[model samples]
Structure formats: C-alpha cells, structure tokens
Target: MTLTLRQPSMLTGMDIPSATQPTPEPAIHVRGLEKSYKDLRVLRGVDLDVARGSIVALLGSNGAGKTTMVRILATLLRADAGTARVNSLDVATRAADVRASISLTGQFAAVDEILTGRENLVLIARLRHLKDPGGIADDLLARFSLTEAGGRRVGTYSGGMRRRLDIAMSLIGNPPVVFLDEPTTGLDPQARLEVWQAVRELAAGGTTVLLTTQYLDEAEQLADRIAILHEGRIVVDGTLGELRRLLPPATVEYVEKQPTLEDVFLTLVGAGTEQGQR
Candidate 1:
C-alpha cells in the first residue's frame, strides 16, 4: 500500500508575528513547572508555551518526566511548585475549568473490549452530558473511518482501529487542547502512519495538540515545533530545521559500486526465470 506523508502546512499563508511582536494568547502556558516525589524530582523549573491551533511534540527518553508533565497539564496531577495554565485557566486553581478545555489520551488505550466501537463513543458522550449522544457517536465513527466496524466489539478491532477509537473518544467534548502521551508507542509502521494522519487532521482543524513520543521521526514529521526534555527540564525547543543546525554539517562521500544482497537475490531470480524459459 502507498502512503502519502502529510506535511505540516497549518502555518502556511498565515502571518507569523515575531517573538518581539505582540501575539495572540497561547493555548497552553507553563512557567517554572516543578514536580517531585519524596526524594526524587521529576520536573525542575520547566517552562513551555504551545500556540493555539498548532502541534507541539515533546520528545524525551523514558523516565524523562514527559508523562509527568502531561498529567500535570491535564489536571490529573498537581505540581509541587510552579504553575501551568490551559486555555488561560490555571491548572491548579481552576482544575475543573482546565479539565473542561482539554482531553488527554494516556499511554495505553482506554476502551471497553466488550463494547462495540459505537457504544464506547456514545458512552463517553453521555458521560459528558451531551444532548444527542448517538448522533455524536455516529459522527466520530465516520470521522475516524470506523463506521463500517461501528457495531463490532472493540475486542475484534485491530490495534490501529482501537487507537483511533480511543482518540475519537477523547474528542467527544470537542476540547480545544488535547494531550497525547506516547500515542503510537507499540504500533507497527502502518499503524503509526494512520495515527500520524489523524494527528495532522487534528492540527489542521485548529485544535492545539501536545504529543509526547519517543519516536524521533514522528516528532520531525508531525510537530510544528519540537521540545526535548532532559533531566527533568527542557534542554531545547524549536522547529526541526532549527534543531538540525545544532548538529555538525553533513559530509558527502562517494563509494565504488558493490554487489549488495538485494542485487544478488534479484540476479538469482532473473537467472532462474531465463533457465525456465529454455
């Protein structure tokens, strides 16, 4: 199957105000964000800003506190120090309001295996007190391309399909800000691409997305800006092009032609075909 990669063009044709220029308010803002557990500190004086209608990828190794940061921003955990705001509401003081403006999909898929795909979405819509839960569920099912399997139990769905449904459930309330924690961790290449397309669509539709992923290529392809967290702090934050400048210049070299295993395999197959023709 052919896959057409989606480029990040959400910023195209838009006038990007300079850093010195006054700009619109950020969708997410954090300053001196600190979190600690007993003797160990998970986050130490972290600061970040995610613009509205853009995708920001937080890249870090395991245990670098990426999940911890997402939890705090999603109002699922409290910060030992510093402050975080989502949609301009304080995550600490206005936890309820912050939660109302954002949806969080954790590292694992949160779906009822026994329930049908449609049923899972409808349950969430009803929990959110939507007036037309069935209508909302149908719409999301269509959006995620799961309408054909809507009536099937989630246990019958593939890994990619289940992740898609999990993301659809997160959008039940139409929150402006969404947090995705290692969304495509264990997915195969094709499954990863499917999720990447979904994320691109989300950003194109003016939803602010903060995604945490260990996959460097995923970050390069999807994020308008990339932030690397190290040792419980942000070591660098910029666009892919800007980050590339930090590395040494590439050295171009030419090598003599040599027979590779692929070439040998193709040659053997061709020889067998010719001999059979005789």
Candidate 2:
C-alpha cells in the first residue's frame, strides 16, 4: 500500500526486442504447480497457460486455491515445487524480471489512506523507478478518472474512487500483464461496473490480465477465458462459449410477475446436474 517495494521486487531482468519472433508461449505458463503446508496440500499439480492480449478469469468456490494461485503468480509466495513464467520470465528465479512485467491488484483496495491519490501513484512510480514521477502520477490519475480528486487524501475517497486509485497505482510502470484477485469484492453495484469497464479497457489495449473471483456473472462479463478451480486444482479451463456448450443451457425468466420457487430453481439449476456454481 505504501508502494515501497516492501521487500526486494522479484521483477527485474532482460528486455527482449519488440521485433523478436513471437513464440507460441503464453503470457503465463504454469506447470505442476504445488504448494503445501506441513502435510496439507493446497495446490496439486496445477497447470495453465494464459495467452497474451487476453483476460483469463479463475472461478471457484470458497476454500479453492484461487488466492494461492494468484499469490504465486504475483511473486508474493513460492511454490513448493513446479514452475511458473510471466512473459517467459520464471516466477521463482527471475522473480524480479517477472515482477517487472506484471502488476497485481489484490482483493481489497490496499491504498494508503494518509496519502493523496496523486501521492499514491507517485509512490509506486518512484518504487518502480519510472522517470518523471509527477508526470507519471498525473497520467495515471487522468487515465483512471481520478484527476479531479488527485490531490485529495485516499481516506476521503468513496469505495469506487479508492479502488480506482489503487488500480491506477499498480499501472504506473505500465506492466504488460496484471493479476487482479477478486477486484470487485466490496464494491456496490455501480462501482463494480466501473471496475469492469476499467478491466475491459486494459484488456482491449493488449495487456494480459488474470482475474480470480467468486462472482460468476463477473467472469462471464469480463473473461475471454474462464478456468474453474476447486479444492486447489483447476477443474476446467476453456472459453465461456465452450463451457456453456458443455453445460446445459440456463433457463430464463422473462416476466411481469415474481416467478415461483420451482421456476427459480429450474432457471438457476439448468437442465444438467453438471452445470453448477463452482
């Protein structure tokens, strides 16, 4: 929240030429990823590939390893075994380089309340060693629609505004990939839409984004691809249309009056038992 690079940033390394031949590799590549605490295994041989210029949403119920996966990708935690690459940079050994290419916004708006919105962005820009700190701050503020509130302390901001500032702070260095963990957790309906719009714009600009959330509707709205995680493992991964095809079509209630309980169940449960919440 203070934007101090709290520990040494795991994100520093070589910059490949833009004109270099593009590999078939994805922006994120995870193979046999495992994490254990004593005898309790939280992640078990998880594997995934996220393409560049896309948004991949991780969906799951409570107790799933979604947050754990996010932490590892963000370089906040180490896997007991397995490999992860961010922009082809290894998450463990090339941590600094990997971090450099990735930006992460955690579930909560972890802003420094004492700092002004402009100060928050400047802090991150400085921590990332970007030139022209003031200019960088100004640019992020304007881009996130926080320009008018730039000078105000984050503590004075509404939930939506604070989240915007928090996300803006993460982008000061213009990382190519971003990991957002349950970004809409605490926002009101309107604030959620604003964040969704921001996420869409980020992906539209060719930034690879990985988002983890419990909200199915959010995933359907924003993810170019969706992967369902359950009990620390990825259960399914594919495009929304693919999943929908595999799943029974959901029934709709188009109406003038309140639907009956049976109608609600039928609409929500769909025709197949396989179509589920997680």
Candidate 3:
C-alpha cells in the first residue's frame, strides 16, 4: 500500500496548555521502567509520558516488550524496576487504585459469544458495580453503532462488531486511562478502521490512550505522539512530524501511481457500515 505520512487532527482537549495555565500532569508516566523473566530482560529502563486526552502509539517489533509495558501500566504485572503511574496513581504502590482508574483491552476480543451485544455490555457494567447497567448498555450500543445488533448473539456478529462491543464494555466505569495492546492485531482493514474510529472517539471524550501496535500507518493515522520501543527501551518518542524529520527529505520522483492492495481490495469489496452485516 502507498502509505503517505499525513498529520492526523488532534483530539479534543489535547491542545497545548497556555503559558498562563499550569500544564496538567500526563495521564500516564513512566521512569526507568524495567522488567525481565529469569535471565531474559524484557524491558530496560524505559521512559514515556502520554498526555491526557491524547492517543500515544507505542510502536515496536514482535517481542519488543510492548505487551510487557502495557501489562505493568495496567497493573496486571509487577515491574522489577522504575516507577510508573496512571492518572497520578502509582502502578506499583497503589495497584488497586491504578486498576480502578484504567482499563486494559488485550489483543483479542474478550466478549462472550453466547451473549448478545447488549447483554455483554450490561454484564460488564454490573461487574463494575455501576447503576443502570441496562441504560449504560443502550448508550454504548448507540455510541458504537451497535444498537441494531444489540439483540443478536455476538457469535453472529462480524469481527469489527465484536471488537467494538469489547471496547464499549471496557468503558463501563469511564476510566480515565486506557491501554490497548495491539487492538487491531488480527483484524482486516475494515475492522482496523472501525477500531481506529472507536479509539478516536475515546480521545474526544477526554480519555487518555496508550496504544501499542507494530503497524506504522496505524500510529501515523491515530497518535498525537509516537514512541518506538526497541530492545526493551524507547528508542524514539515524538510527534509524527518530529519522527519524519529524523530521516532526510524524500526524493521527488515521478512514477505511475498504482493502487495498493488495500485500495483495490477495499474498492472491490467496498466499506461496510458499523453493523458489519454478519
């Protein structure tokens, strides 16, 4: 695919703080974060900061400790060194508080296939001890454009629809920070687009997002800033423009433009609505 690096619009409430105003603390912060299993060091003194109400993509190749970073931040795993915080709560010292303030969406969709979309949402809301679970379910269904499929079994829903439902469920308690570990790992182009839009909406609603993906285009299309993790540490961190500056300017050459596989496949099959007609 002919992937051009274009700037994505900043999410709402993600503007730089004025000089008159004190800068708000980043929603996610890490300093000297490290992890290891036996003799295999997974992370080595990694540091990063994700601004509130913004999307920060952590790019890395397979086994680059991307998932390990997310796990430590999400309070699912303990870090052997360094400090990390989510929403001003320490992931190590205050694991419970950090867990309450954030949600983690893994690579796979975590939905019950036997249940309908609405049922799955309601179940999560109740598990979080929220009131009006039914109402919350209805609201999320409409927000993710799943109202029509709300009553249908998730087993019958398309990949995109199931993923949307999983994300909606994660927002049950309105967590301030969200960790998406390769959210589009196995999805097709259409499903990836669906998740991208859902993530954009999350940022618009003032949620901080730390997205881990190996897809360069995904980071280019969605992140306010991109952090590249290499050899268990962040090798680079900056906006897309800043990262682009690291490389020399592209040479201008004229060549016949050809349709990318993505373009041709999408053109031939066409895009689908959120319903994703299972």
Candidate 4:
C-alpha cells in the first residue's frame, strides 16, 4: 500500500516558526531503497516517508529485512541501490550529516556495566563534546527516572534500568531522529511500558522516531503510522484503521466477556510506575 501524507507540521508546543509559513521537511525520506548481500536481495525498491515528530513503526516477521533497512537508514550499513535522506541530507553522500541528525538503539542495550549509570551518560556526553556533560547527564538521569539509581554501578542495575540508560545515552545530543530496533525485546511488561512512555515523550518533544518491532500490540499502542515489511518490501503502510479496512469484514459475534492473559498478567504485576518501580 502506498503511504501518502500531508506536508509535515511541527508538533504542538515545539519552538518553531509559525505553521502558517512553509511546512517543514520530512524527518526521513526514502525512495526506491534497496539492499542485498552476496547475491541475496534483502530489500526491493522500498519507498517510505516519515513525518517530523511522528512515531512510525516498521513491523515484520523474521528475516523480513527490517533490521537491514534500519541499519541502512542509521548509516551503519550502506544500501546497494536507491536513495535515502535524513533531514534532507543524503545518506550516501552526506553520511556524517545524517549521523549528526540521528541516533540509533539496537535490539540489545548498549551500556557499560563496569561504570555507574551516571558515569556512562557523562562519558557519552563528553564524547559528544557537549559544553556541560555533567549537567546533561544529570538531567537525562532525572528525565528517565534513573536519578535514584544513577550513582549505582551499572552491573547492579536491573535490565529495565540498563535499557533506560542506553536510551538516555542515545538522546545525549538530542538528535532530531532516533531509530529503535526491537527496544522492548526481552523486557518485562512493566519495563516495556516504561520504554513506551519514554518513546511517547520523545515524539511529544518533537523528535522523530522510527522503530522496528515484532509485536503487533506494540505497533498498535505506540505507532502513529505502521508499515509492514514483507518479501523485501513494504507490503502495507498506513494508519491502523486504514490497514484494518484492507482486511475482510470481521464476523461479529456476541459472547460473554472474558479476561485476557494480558489482563491477568497486568493484574498480577500491578500498575508499576513508568520508572519501573515495583
């Protein structure tokens, strides 16, 4: 399905020029994007456009080239054919500029277990050459609700805390775009909700997010738009309602309401805070 959208607009409360003016450029733009490995084609003429400050979920089954497409867009891997641009900068010719405009978090958390959570953020901030690395670290620690555990060694941090820290590090430079590849993988339900809130806050703050996930519910919960990758291409791309319309009419049936497994799980787990506090 072709994904068509109106000209991108700045999110509410964003400190930008008046919308009555010209529309801002798309955060991500791809046309006829393709990739391959050793005679095996992974992507075949994929076309996509992600608006500024919106969350777009890329969903697909295993070996569907979701990760491959993400890697190419993140500048970690080059596409074999087609073109991609981030913030209007070409990924192939302006790789550095593209990198400067985006941050990427892979499927697993990437944090230094040997150091304190605070130290890890400070280290990344310093590497980014920020004027106030300590201040930035402190703010991010508080933003992610890690301030209470910031001083503890990362080795002692829970999986949820580590994932939060990893995401915090990615936001050090406040890149306009972020790529999250299965960020909630292996996370408990509570931890997953924490990450989901973080992602929501990012988009609310005018950051464009492109995420890939295997979870359908996750896509429904977090995505403003959803694109399904299949057979080396985006077979379906649209809003959830739009995509649902593509399906055959459902056979409506009235039955007694029953609690789902998720309901039971959430009941047992309790409604933990977004910080993953039990």
Which regions of candidate 4 deviate over 4 angstroms?
A: 1-21, 274-278
List lDDT for all candidates, in order: 0.82, 0.80, 0.85, 0.84
Off by over 4 Å in 1: 1-22, 254-278
Q: List the residue pairs that clash in candidate 2.
A: 10-95, 10-96, 11-96, 11-97, 11-99, 11-100, 12-96, 12-97
Per-residue lDDT of model 1, residues 111-192, tens digit only: 9999999999989988877778888888878777788889989898888788988998887766778999999999755567
Model 1: lDDT equals: 0.82
Candidate scoring better on TM-score of 2 and 4: 4
Global fold similarity of model 2 (TM-score): 0.83
RMSD of each predicted structure: 9.6, 9.6, 6.7, 4.8
**Candidates arranged by lDDT, highest first:** 3, 4, 1, 2
- Candidate 4 local accuracy as lDDT? 0.84
lDDT of 4 at 12: 26
Worst 10 residues of 4 by lDDT: 1-10
Candidate 2, residue 68: CA error in Å?
0.8
TM-score of each: 0.83, 0.83, 0.90, 0.90
Please provide, for model 2 over 1-278, each residue's C-alpha lDDT reduced to its tens digit, 9 standing for 90 to 100: 10112212112212222434445478889999999888889899899999877899999987688889999998999999999988888899988888888899998898999999889888888898877888878876777778788888888888878887777777666677889989999886656777888788777666789999999999999999999988778889999999988977888978789787746765675532211111
Name the regions of candidate 3 deviating beyond 4 angstroms.
1-21, 274-276
Query: Between which residue pairs do clashes occur in model 4?
Result: none
Instruction: Give a tens-digit lDDT track for model 3, residues 1-278.
Output: 11111112211223332234356678888999989999999999999999877899999999999999999999989999999988878898889878877889998888999999999998988887777888888888887889989999999998888888889887777777889889998888988988999899888767789999999999999999999999989999999999999999989999999999999998887766557456
